[model samples]
Every structure is written in structure tokens, then in C-alpha cells.
Target: MALLDTLHRWAGGFVGLVLALLGLTGAILVHRDAWIMLPHAGDAQIQSTHVLAATTERLMSNPETRPQSVTFANANLGLDRLDFGKGAGAYTEQAGTIVSQWQTQWARPELWLFDLHHHLLSGDTGETIIGIAGVAGLFFVITGTILWWRTRKTFAFRPLPKRLSRPAIVRHHRDLGIVAAPLLVLSLLTGATLVFRPISAVFLGPGAPATIDTALQAPKGPKVALADHLDWRRMIVTARARFPDAELRSLSLPRKESGLVTIRMKRPQEWLPNGRTTLWFAADDGRLIGARDAASLSNVVAAYNILYPLHAAKVGGLGYRLVMTLSGLTLGLLGTLSVWSFWFKRPRPVKVRRGVRP
Candidate 1:
């Protein structure tokens, strides 16, 4: 028991700051659409196929300014986003007027904050560190709960420590940790699973990862060069004709040697902000090559898809966003205070006079 307590304290001291940063950033990111103050950002989403097709055609008409991809407006944010690759992008109105353009993610708080929260700004290495921190945080929650059991009778709810003293902080930590354990578990597990796909097997069952990989594997066929002036409108119209119930979510140009344009959509039934229902078209002649209905995915894969929405509060509207915001804030508070208590609030060593008394 003592060893467990010591390990928890030490682990908290080591990874607490990282967890705090992730929590605070995640909280802010949950309201990204609300806080991003671009022109027409708050305008209501327009899902009319004519408007969508015209706007997409206009944007892609200019090869010089054409983005590699376009993420369509949703109910929360009315601006379409264009990704030009290499950290360059712009946001445009539904009518295809460019509102804001950036050469790099540094020019936008929302972009960099997302990058920081997801990758710690160090790419894959930082992502691995974040995954490690999430694992440590889970350990803290589980072991903290066990340790709290000993003093459960003395539990008192306090949002903050009544005072800065060690004992007070410890008590606050215990009570708050217990109060926020469930939320913390949900947030941490979903987050860690995103970075480490194999972990999904725990919640999604064995072979789940393999199943998802097989299902999502891109088509293998003879590759062709992308046509200079493919019919963007026709492609959009065709996709809409096929999935009349789904909202156009995103469209991506083929990458490298792959000659397929991918169109993604969100159905009303999907919890993922960008629903997995997808259509693939040959880039050379814009012929429909394949499609996948997200709703018809394997049960395990379907359950796996809900993790992002659950973690990021992408669904459930304002109420769920607020719930997730509270979870993030609570995690931040716990991590920040845990670090302080473990490092700065330690007991001071006692001194004795040399040979003065025995």
C-alpha cells in the first residue's frame, strides 16, 4: 500500500504538467467553432447540393489556388476550410469567398492549439509522449482511488484546496480525484486509444483492430494520373445522389501515386463529426470506384468509431461540450495541484546539534 502511494506520487510529479497542458488545451479546443472569429464563421450551415457543388467547383477551378482538400461547413461552424498541405490553409465562406488565409499553423491559435493538444508540436514523438502521459494519468486515477479508499470516511468535496498546506492539498486531491475519476477515465482511455490503436481491442474486443484495418484498406488497382479539369460538380452530384441522407463533410485529392478522390459525409445517425460514410472516385475520369456506408460497418468497428466523439465532445451539442469542458478543467486542476503537492510540499529534514545531547 505504501509502495503504491509512493509510486502514484512520483508518477504524478513526473507527468502532471503534461497532463495539465493537454487538459487545458483540450478544454479550449472543445469550443473551437464558437471561439474562431472569422467572417461568416457563425453563419448557419447550408447543405444545398447546388451551393455545395458550385462552391467546390469554384474553389477547385483555379489549380494555383486549389487546396489539396476541403472540409465543408457543419452546423457549428459555417466556414469551409481548405488545406493546401505543408501547414498552409484558408477558411472560406459557404459562398466561396476567402475569409482568412494562413501560411502556417502558427498564424492561427485554433490550428496550433489543435496541433499542440494532439501532437505537442513535435509530431509523432510528441504524440507518443502524450500517450505515455495518458497511461500515467490512468494509473494515477486507479491507484489514487485505491489510496483514497483508506480515508474515504474523511472525504470532503472542495473544488480547490482550502489552504496551500500539504495536508490540505492531499485531502483536496483525494476528494477531487474520486469525484472526477469517471470523467477522467473516459477522457484518458479514449485519448490513449486514439494514439495506440491496439488498445482498442480492450474495449472493442479481440481482432477489432485487424477488422477495422481490413475494412478501411484503400482499393488496389491500376493507378492513373489525375485529370487537369475533373468534373467537381458532377462528382459531388453523384455522391449526393448515392447517399441522399448524408451531409458532405470533406473532399480530398489523391495523394502521391494514388489516383482517387475521396469524399466523406456525415449521416444523422453518425456520432463522428466527420461521418465515415465515404465514396472514392477515380481521379483520371472521375468515375465512381467504391463507397462505404459507415452505418453498415462491423459492430466492433462501429463501436470503435464513437471514441473520438466521446473524447472530443464532437456530438451531443452544447450540453455534452460543457460536460467535457468540466472534465478537462478538473483534470487540469488535479494535475497542477498534484505536481505542486508532490514537489514543493514535501517534508523538510530535521537537523540535530553535533554531540550536544545523547
Candidate 2:
């Protein structure tokens, strides 16, 4: 009880409010990718490698925008995301019209939201403030647990008050806080991982994590002339023949002489945003070179990979995603209720008799 009160007191009014706001936003954003990935946007088949090559040629050869990067999207409404060096390009899955992109400092709405979540969308200051907020959240959760522990004997999840005389806001605050404490803790802890990555890296051994990043970012080895190409259809055929069970999510064409054509395939039973099998091809000759097994990643890298998808519930499918989203919202609500309870429902000081009380 002392710890809970102390933690609550230490949380202050404004900081707690901010954390709650962040949690609320994060809860909303948590399942966005899953929702966005659904068929709501528009239909465009994930183009074949040859077809993609031809499209690239056509788009580039067209009098308009030049191709910058091709982002292969998975599923329907998941037309490949093509980036042009110029700010104006097109999202084929989203109406096939040329769109000029804008973000806080990045180039997309998603990035803007992400920046808002982590950095309060203010760049470095937002990042630092949010990082501090996460650390504070961890503190509050631990202290709250310690306090909640002392009162376990009387703990009950009574969200609605039976008494008609009780104030509604205070009741709402207390009950909501009681029910959502666990979820708030979870949302905070998972989010903190992004800021404090080194906490888990200690277990991954020396230099192994850096190695994994390098491997995942392996270069497109030795680019050949774009004039003669295998094209998208054949490329897809070749990749399918090579890895039968893999789902093609992305394909990055080589940009330079040393570039390699990279095919990223989805992994089985994984929750984070990672593909177990990454097949690299000599961009010029379609030669298969090095492959990365996601299952075999160093503990540090694997841990990092699992965090985002788990945070967003993407790796866990619909049910898991729902659970995560609800958890975040619950936490936010709980945090808000907690502060309200403390602010409005604290016990009144004892009254003294008129004169001879001393």
C-alpha cells in the first residue's frame, strides 16, 4: 500500500497523463498494419519478377517519375510499394494514382505515426522524452505491483459500484485501474524494449548481434546491365522452384555492379517481422549465393525481430493481435483511472474537535 501510494505520488499528474496518452495511441496503432494489410485498399496481384522488371522499365521509361526502390507487399491491396527519387510516386494498391508523400520528417503516414508513438513525433526530443517516459513507466509498474501485492488479500475486480451515493468518476477511475494494471505493465515493458535494446543483448554474446544485422543487410552482389534481364515472371518462377514453401514478401533489385537480387520469404510459426529464409541471387546472372536462416539468428537479433511483431500481434495472427491491442487500451485506461482515483478519492484528513482536542 505504501509503495503503491508512493509510486502513484511519484508518477505526478502530467507524466502519468502523457504515458496514458501514448498508450492510447499505441493501442490504436498496434493492429494498424494487420488492418492495412487486409483487402480494404484495392486489388493488385503481387507482380511476377519479370512483370515487375517490365513494370520498372515502363515506369522508368515513362515520361514521369523514375523508380527508386520497389517494396513488394504481401497479399491483396498489397501491391508493391514503389519509391521514386522525386517525392511524387504512386501506391498501385491504393487506386493506382500518383501520390505525393508527406510525413513528419519521413515519407509516409505509417512512419509519422511510429514517430509520434515513440518520439511524440518531435524528432530527437520526442524520442528522448518518450524514452524517459518508458523508463518511468517501468518504474511505476514495478512500484505499483509492490503496492498491489500488499493488498492482494482484499483485491477484487469490481468495476461498477453498487452504492448509488459514490461519485461516478472516482468509481470509474478505481475500478478501471484495478482491472487494467496487468495490461498497462505489459504494454510498457514491451515498448521499453525498443529503447533499451541493450538489456537483452547482454545474453546474445559479443559481436554476434552486429553480425546478424550485417547479414540481414547483405549487399546485392555485382549488378549487371539492366538492358538484358530475366524479367519478373521468370524471376518468380526461379525463386518458387528454389524455395517451394516460402511466401514471397519482398524482392530488391540490385542497384550497382556489386548488387544482388534479394528475395525475402516469410517464416513459419514466427511472430516478429522476420523471414527465416533469405535467398540472394547474383542480380546479373540469377545465381543463388548466401542464405539466412531466421531460426538460426543470434539470440540478440532474434529477440529484436520478435519484439515488433509481438508488440503489434502480426506474428500471432488475428486473435493474438486483438489480445495485444486490447492489452494496450486497457493499460491506457487503467493509467488514467489510477491518477484520477488518487487525485479525487484520497482519504480526507481527520477532523479535530473545536477546542480541547489537544
Candidate 3:
């Protein structure tokens, strides 16, 4: 019992700030589509696949700013996204004119918060640290629940403690931590697994491949110049013909001279809104060169895919978003209060009956 108490306090005290930051950032990200507020160009009336393809191809024609990828605007959102490079993205109308630039966190709070949450402002190294923090968060949750079990009879849900005293705060921390343990564990475990993908194999099964790395290389064909007009309509038609049941989602144009055009799609049965299935086309002639179907994924890989949407609450619309939001808030509050209780608050000494004793 003492060991559990010491472990919980030390872990919470050391990583509480990071966990709180992650929770706060995650809460903000849950409503990203609503808050970013990228100006919509009014919905396009024409919804032809060919027109959509043409719009994207036209956008890539610009030599000064070649896009790395282009995400089509949702009918409701009214603008597509053009990613020029890392940390550089712009919203555009169906015609592909710039509506807004969201390369920096200051300009786009959601994107900045997203990078901070996922990458910790330090790229892969930071992600590894955040991943470790997530594991630590899981530890806290498990240990906290065990500790709370000892005083389960006294559990009471309260918005805040009855008083500003140390004892009052401790009670709030204990009760709230216990209440939020399950959710915190889920969020932390999922988020951590995403960062450290290798951890996924443990749950997936021993020896399961944790990643699938595919790249588009230069094919044996006449090299196409950037100025050469691309048959945009043909590419879309080819992709549809190949995957009739899949919904077209986004397209990534090759950044390098030998790069291939990659398309992302969502099948009907997929839980992820963006879809994991991908197809690559030769940039020179729009020939289908490579493909990965969601339906054909292995059990381990398929199981791993579910974790992302689950952690992000991307499946159940607004209701699930609210649940995730509450979970995040609970974690932030629990971590903050626990840290305060452990480090800052001092135990109050009992008053003596001075009138009789001295």
C-alpha cells in the first residue's frame, strides 16, 4: 500500500504537467473541424469526379509552390487543403485558389496544438518522449485505481473540494482520479501506441509486423515534364474502376521528380473516416502502379488501425466527441490536483488548547 502510494505520487508529480498538456490539447483537437474555422468558398454545386480531379491538377501546375498532397474539401467544409511541405498547408476552393494559409500555430491554433500534442515540438524524438509519458500515465491510472480502492467507501463525486484545505484537495484528487481512471487509461494507451507503433505488436500478437512502408520509385517510362498536361479525369476513372465500393478521399502528388501520385480512399465498412486503403499512379501516364486495399489488410494491421479512430473519437460524431472531451478534461483536472496535493500543499497542524496547557 505504501509502495503504491509513493509510486502514484512520484509518477503523477513528475509527469502531471505533460499529461495535463496532452489532455488539454486533445480536448481542443476533438473539435478541430469546428474551431479552425477555415473560410469556406461556398459549396461547389458540381460534384463530378473529373471536375474534382481537374481542380487538383490545376493547383499543382504552379511551379513556385508544388503541393505535396491535396485533400479535397468536404461538401460541408467548402475548401480543399493543399500541403506544400511540412508545417505548410493552405485551404483552397474547388478551383484550387488559396483561401487561407495555416502553416504556423499562431495562424491556425488547431494545427499548432496538433503538432504539439503529437510531436511535442521536437519531431520524432519528442514523439518518443510523449509515448513514454503515455506509458507512465497508464501506470498512474492503474496505481491510482488500486490506491482509491482502499477508500472506495468514501468515494464522492464533487466538482471541487468542500474547502481549499490540503485534505479537501486530496479527497478531490483521489475520488476524481478513481472516477477518471478507465478513460485516462484508454486515451493514454491508444495515444501512446500511436506514437510508438512497435508497442502495437504486443496487443496484435507476437511477430506481427507493426508497419507497412511503401514508396513510389521511377518507373521505366518516358519522363514527364512538370509542364506536361496530366490526364486528371483518367486517373479518377481508373481508381473508381479498380475499387468500386470505395469512396475517394484525398490525393498526394509526388514531391520529387520521380515521385508517384498516391490516392487515399475510404471503403464503406471502414471505421476511419479518411480510409486506409491507398493506390499509387504513375505521374507520367496516370497508370496504376501500386495499391493497398483496406479489405485485404491482415488481422493485426486491421486491429491496429482501429486504435487511431478510437483514440481520436472520430467515429461516433458529436456524442463521442463529447465523451472524449469529458475524458480529457477529467484527466487534466486529476493530474493538476494530484500534483498540487503532492508537491505544494502542506498538511495542516491541529490547534492546541492553549488556555489549559501552557
lDDT of each: 0.92, 0.59, 0.76
Per-residue lDDT tens digits of candidate 2, residues 1-358? Answer: 6656765665744477677778777877765554444233445555454554455444444434434555555542355566554333345543233333432235565555666787786767887777677778767666655655655675556555444332554355444555666766566666666666544444456664565556567744555654344444455566666665666665665555655666676666445543656777775566676777666776567766766666665655667667777776665765675566567665688888889565
TM-score per prediction, in order, is: 0.97, 0.68, 0.87
Count the clashes in each prediction: 0, 17, 0
Residues 307-338 of candidate 3: C-alpha lDDT, one tens digit per residue? 88889988888998998998888877777777
Candidate no. 1 TM-score? 0.97
For residue 108, model 3's alpha carbon misses the true position, in angstroms, by 1.1
The better candidate by lDDT, 2 or 3, is 3
What does the lDDT read for residue 74 in candidate 2? 55
Worst 10 residues of 2 by lDDT: 95-104
Measured on C-alpha atoms, candidate 1 has an lDDT of: 0.92
- Candidate 1 has its poorest 10 consecutive residues by lDDT at 213-222
Candidates 1 and 3 compared: the better one by TM-score is 1
The digit string of per-residue lDDT tens for model 1 on 1-358 reads 9999999999999899999999999999999999888889999999999999999999997777799999999999999999999899999999889999999999999999999999999999999999999988899999999999999999999999999999999899899999999999999999998898888888788898899888877776349887788899999999899999999999999988888999999888889998999999998889999998988888888888999999999988899999999999999998899889889999898777898773
Order of candidates by lDDT, top first?
Answer: 1, 3, 2
